[model samples]
Target: MRLFLVSQLLLVFISVLALTRAQTAPPTTTDTATTETSTAQPTPTDTATTTQAIAIATTTAWTAPPIFYPFGSAAGDTEQFENGGDTYRDVAFSTPFMFFGRMYNNTYVNNNGLLTFNQPLPEAHPYPFPTHGSEDFIAPLWTELDDIGIGRYSYQQYTNGSVLTRASQEINQYFPHKGFSASWVFVATWDYVQTSDVNVLNLHSAPAITFQVVLISGGGYSFILMNYGDCAATYYPVEAGYDTISSTDYHVIHYAFDGSYIPNLKNTSNVNVPGRWAFLVNNGTETENVIGVQLKLSSFLDLTLNENIEDVLQKIKQELVNRGASSFFEMKLRNVETDKEKNVAGRETFELITLT
Candidate 1:
């Protein structure tokens, strides 16, 4: 009887051990398939989906922002451009405006889109800067724009305390160097101006381009502000920017060479302000120093795009060190890095970047 009891107890213990082992065993294939189903149901492609969304946002069309001065007949102080093709009107500034180391008290506002100091550029066709031309002009949009009985173009100058304060604040914010105070402000606007190539009788039915070129001067410093509004597409050669006497100091706004991109100027900006671009037209002694250094460096670097990029960079770096202009080189490197992040390699204008 004792031996029987011992064997029975031992069998019960063995049974309990086997039951525990079964409970603790690995999962079955079905269990694994269920888990994988939850994880693999198109949920792993989130990163790619986000990347696609970002690309769409980046490629979206740009529009003009409201950063322009008030204009039109309602403004009451504006002088209107005549309703004729390729017409120009001479206007005298209340104060002498300094531009690129020169002073001017009078300029002609041409309907085709240019401000000339000496005479009117009656030609409707646009030309690239350094035209090696004798005329000094500021072209907001040098296109064949027909204002004949259609669009209205106008000009206004302000020397009021309120206007001066606003101009000072804007220039300081955009350029951000030494503080600037404006004593004189000249505003020329091309409002609802249609391309001459268009044959529409009703201006409302035709596409139009509206923009402004504001000249600000004070404390021996000068600035130019190009404010764009709704711009229509065009097929003609369009040039927008400025040139000094003999093209000694000149800059062509981006997309000025291509007609398709002319409308894009309404959205493009140099200071990251949409619809607006601000440029320091005169820097006094600083301009002289830069030109001198530029000439010295130009002798070493072939900016004609004939040399390899790496070779050009090496030459510039060595020349900067020899001339104690390494600070300028470093600043350019920082600018290049910043522009690279924006993916504007060919579109951006940096110091010594003109490939003329």
Candidate 2:
């Protein structure tokens, strides 16, 4: 009877120990997974909560504020340079500006309302953009502008925190989805600049053109903002836009090509804000037009009808393809006559071709 009693106690103790171990030990992988799946199943309340979170995130969209910057003596900032007629001042950039694919560490700020890289364009007169010109330039009112006597022009560059923040915010508002942050900004203002023709023609009165060109760059991206303020009508040919070397990329502002409609620039805008135009110019794949590509080809290739014409056509086709042109597009050569010797300074006079 004692032996049987001892055996029963031992069995009871072993069972108790097993129960304790089972209670204290970590669960097996399969058991843990089963428990999680059972409890973690989505309820209607969880679905509603997730949907609400997504809605809240989507509702918080960002919008850019006003597009204006301070300038002149009253603004108590900016570096003023000597003003002249048809002359340009070589200004070194605090940071290099990447344009198209070229990097420029300096620029020639011309008095006639333009910024030219590679060389200075001191001509008092203005020409239409996509001139197929060799020099790459940015014109905010490229005319015979004179700030020598009556007007003031100044520039300021920013690497400061506040200005960088403002630049980032303004660019984000204009070109969204890039999540851009501006590391450098250069602001050039042509305040109350008068037309050079006024003095030459001896006019009793002339209109004053006020505008600003702001360069914002960061993270291999570059942008330009042309801001107009109270641009009055002028009798000079004013071209407002930018052109790349070989005319690969160019944009001409509406009404700016004709001199008579100069005042319209003050109220017109590309971003819905009056007197403002913004453009992304560093990698200009998005801004380049089909016409620009044709011009680019004209600048390089001698599109003469020769025995190797087939090879020339194939070369042109391949060039277009290399530049992201669709294979299904149509191209037509217009006015390829031999008498059309309008090619001057690498600018072909005859319309080489049109791409559609």
Candidate 3:
């Protein structure tokens, strides 16, 4: 009877163990949704070969937008450029298939091709976003779009009262030099979060006049923009920045805005309001939209694209002492090496505003 009892007990224990396992086991999912979520993120792609830099500074005046639409059925069709530009197609592609590099596919080269900026923004933007190199800009804390280089976000917009056309407090271009104009675009996006008395967007902060500049390869970038700064930054000159992405990359930029043109304006004007500027070191993500801040641009009569990105970086280092951070600045260079190469992007210039 004891042996029989022992065998029965053993069987009971095995049964209980099997029941527990079954209860705790995870269910096998065969649905497509489950499969997609399980492996949604893409692995990092190999670094691309360093591209040759292009110089856009022609002596002739640029009557047309830097990019030309390759194909179209009408003259008024609307399209967004790769580098965050919304446009109203003024004239169709009249120039010989000219091109410029922009946030991935700034132009709709595909028109019907199915392979441009073809990924979701989350997957397309750079990961580990370069929030680490805040010190370079001189600000202990960095704001949005600080070092964002050019990507394929800009497109053509052909509307009358869209965000690209309306809401510009000022869309003044500068003739920093005789032969060239500070040709940059400044668009107003949504408001950003801030806690300053400066009253951005009449009250809110950040996302002030989203802007961008072009690189050596003709890609648009955001190097300078408006911001909601700290106590010290809110007053006098204002809190602004120029990150390493634009400072280090690119050949030349025509920072469209200039506060000095209007004397005695720092106390009231947005141009003079931005005083302290900083540069954030590259975070090493080659392909991502960047953030930006406001800056005081210097009057450059003949700024040209730099031949070497390193030289441009070194010049910026020197300017920290020469120009200092007192509002008022200027930069002219082109080309950014990809993470595959340390290069990247813009201008009032919002090049990369990546606040998602």
Candidate 4:
């Protein structure tokens, strides 16, 4: 009886140890996989999210960078240079001063330095109208406005305003006093909402139709509407006397009409317009014919200063834009100004001095 009782206790101990091992030991691979498949399996939505993330990463990858456009000349000396990073070409110039720079206006930047186009290019920003090396360094942004004067210029902050209906705007655009403004009024067939500010060359459109407008701040400009679709807006002619100067406000209006009235109002079958104010008047409603307008500051300068850098180690970070080149570059340095006065230089000063 004693031996049987001892055997029974041993059997119970072995069974209890087996049960504890089974509960505490790691699960087999097949068992773990079965549990994960039901709870942690990747869904279709998760797979699609991963795929789109990779596509965005691939498309936005930066191009081979650190591009350099190096230029300079020491007053009447012939100078030649080459870009070590990019351009895949050499530049040579025999002139007094070579135009090169990115920013820091009025101060000479470098006699031997490079202008970097992509200082970490952003995904979106104001792009230059004419890219560099286009037209042999001739800035394309001023292609239409170049006939007025060749200069380094951009739209000023003081000149920011929307076109008010029936309200005449007299904008004193940039320094040296160039460009034109108008008091304009219009009636649209659809409910009109002039929400976007009419920047000089930015495209503005209505949701109803495919037509667009640009209020380029030049004396004479041509706007080509990238029109498409099943809908097109038709423009009418101005009244016989709408182009006359307003007697009360002394505001002048000019119209280039279809030749039932004015002998010169014939369409030349070309898209280019002469730098004069005109209206496409049809049947007499000003709004029906005035699809667009041209404000005029028609002057001409032959050349512009581009760079004013004085330090070799200093490089202003700027996005490479085809904003195009200007014949005259005007700059202002707030650092050179005092609270009471501005220590600006004259626009007519240039140099050809030898450092030796």
Alpha carbon lDDT of each predicted model: 0.67, 0.68, 0.26, 0.22
TM-score of each: 0.61, 0.57, 0.23, 0.21
Counted clashes in each candidate structure: 0, 0, 72, 38
Better of 1 and 3 by lDDT: 1
Could you tell me how far off, in angstroms, the CA of residue 169 lies in candidate 2 after the best superposition?
0.8
Q: Tens-digit lDDT track for model 2 on 184-236?
A: 98888775535444242222144556788999999888988888875666666
Residue-by-residue lDDT tens digits, candidate 1, 1-356: 99999999999999999999999999999999999988875555887898899987655643324688766655655655445656678899999987766789899988877898988876657777656578777888887676333566788899886767888999888767667888899888875545343234223445667788999988788888888877777776788877767655566674354467877887777667878777777764453332312321222233434233344444454344334221122212212212334444423322343211
Q: On a 0 to 100 scale, what is the lDDT of residue 316 in model 1?
A: 55
Steric clash pairs (candidate 2):
none
Q: RMSD to native for every prediction?
A: 19.9, 23.4, 25.9, 25.1
The top-ranked prediction according to TM-score is 1
lDDT of 1 at 241: 76
* Span of 10 residues, lowest total lDDT, candidate 4: 312-321
